[model samples]
Target: MSYKPAHAGSGPASNSLRILETVARFGTGTTAKEITDALRMPPATAYRLLNALVGDEYLVRTSDLRGFALGHALSGLVAAATPPTVCTAARTIIDEFRQGVRFAVHLMMFRSASLRVAEEDPDYPLHSVFELLRYPHASAAGKLMLAELGDPALALPGGQLVKVTDHTITDSGRLEEQLAEIRVAGQASEINELEEGSASLALPVQLPDGSAGAALCLTGPAERFTAISEHAEAARELTVRLKPLLF
Candidate 1:
C-alpha cells in the first residue's frame, strides 16, 4: 500500500500550510502578492488564508502592514524545531562587536530585495525594529547591499527611494551616485538619513564567491558618527573582526 502526504494537493488546509512555508522561506517576510505569485493561488484565496493565519496567531502582519511574518506561535514552533548553534554564533559575534564598539550592532542579510536583521544588539536599540525593513534606501546597510547589486538593485521596491527624513536621498539620480561611492569606498554610512538623531555605518561581509553575503552595521546617535574619519576607522575595525567569523 502507498501513502500520500496530506499537503500534496490543493485544499484549504494544504494551501494554508503552503502559505506558511512560503512566508517562512522569505527571510524578510512576504507580501500577499508574493504569496499569490509563488503558489499560483487565486488572490482572493490567498488573502483569506493569510487573514485566517494572522487571526489564529500563526502569522503576523509586518509593522508596516505591507507583509506577513511568522507570529509568536509559529516562531516558537520554528525555534523548537531547529538547532540553536547558528543563533548562538550570530549572537556571540554581535555581542562582541557591541561590547567593542559601545554601539548598537546589527547583522543584516539582503535577500529577495529585502533587508532582514538576523541578529541585533538588544541592549541598545537605535530605530524602530521595522524601520530597516520599511526604509532600506535610507540606511547604510541597505545602501551597501544595493551597491553590491549594482544596476539591477534599482528595480527593487525600496529603490523608489522614499524619503524617510529630511536627509534622505529621494532623488534616484543622487541615490545612484551615493551607491557608486559606497561601492568604491567598500563601506557605507548614513547620517540623519533614516532618522533625525541617528546614524549608521555598514560594511559588507564578502562571501566565498566574492559577493556580499551580509552587512555588518553599527548605529548610534548622529553626534557620535558625524565625523568621517571616525566612521571609517570603526567600520574598518569591525569589518576585520567580522570577516574571520562570518566568511
Candidate 2:
C-alpha cells in the first residue's frame, strides 16, 4: 500500500493541496485508499493527510465515514475564489447603460446569504442609503434575488422582510405574492421603496446553468422611471445585451 510521490520534489503543503484538489475532482467522494492510488503516496501518508484535512474542517467524512468530501470551509474558499463571470459582463453593461441613460446602475449578486453590490457605475455612484447590502424587500435587485431563490431562501436565519419605507413590503405572505409576480413578469421594480424619490428597475441575469445568476439594475429619481413602458424597454435592452455574454 506504500508508494512514492506522484509529483516528485513537491513539499508536504503542496501534496496536501493536491490531495484536496483530487478529492474535489471526484465530486462524489474519495476513500483514503483511492487518494493513495491516485497520488501514488504511501497509504499511511494519504490517511494522515486525509485525517488532518477532516480535523481542520477543510474536508468532511461521508455518512459512512469511509470517504471524504469537501467541507463548508473548502466550499467557501471555492466560492470566494471563483467570481461569477456574469458579474464582470454585467459590470460592463451597467457602465455603458449608465452613460446612455444618465442614471446610477448596479450589479448585485446573492452571495454568502446576502445581496452584495458587486459593481456600480463609477461616474454616477449609488446613493449612501443603497450602498450597503441590505433591504431585500425594498430594492428591485434584492427583490429579484429573493424571487429567484424561492420559499426555502425565506426560511434562512436573518431573512426577515423588514420595512425600509412606507412602500416596502413587510408581510411575508404579501412579499411572496410579489415575488411570484416578479417571476412571471421576468423583472422587478421599486418606486420610493428603498428611499423616497428613488426608483429602480431590475432584470434577472440568467446563468449558464439556467438559474438566476445576478440582477442588472438601473436606479435614479422616481420621475425618470415612472413609466411602465420605460421599464419594459430597459429590461428588454439589458436582456438583449447580456444574452451573448451570459450564455
Candidate 1 lDDT, 9-73, residue by residue in tens:
67898889998999989845599988887787778888999999999999998889999988887
Candidate 1 positional error at 53, Å: 24
lDDT of 1: 0.75
Q: Model 1 off-target regions past 4 Å?
A: 1-87, 152-155, 227-247
Query: What digit string (tens of lDDT, one per residue) describes model 2 on residues 1-247?
Result: 4488978898878988999988988865688878888889887777888888889899999999788899988887677556555547655765666666656767776665456666767776777455235667788877787788886255234767666778877887888898899999988998888888888888877777766767878788888886533655766678667756755
For each candidate in turn, give its C-alpha RMSD to the true structure in angstroms: 11.8, 7.5
Clashing pairs for predicted structure model 2, backbone only: none
TM-scores for every predicted model? 0.61, 0.64
Model 1's TM-score against the true structure: 0.61
Q: Global lDDT of each model?
A: 0.75, 0.75
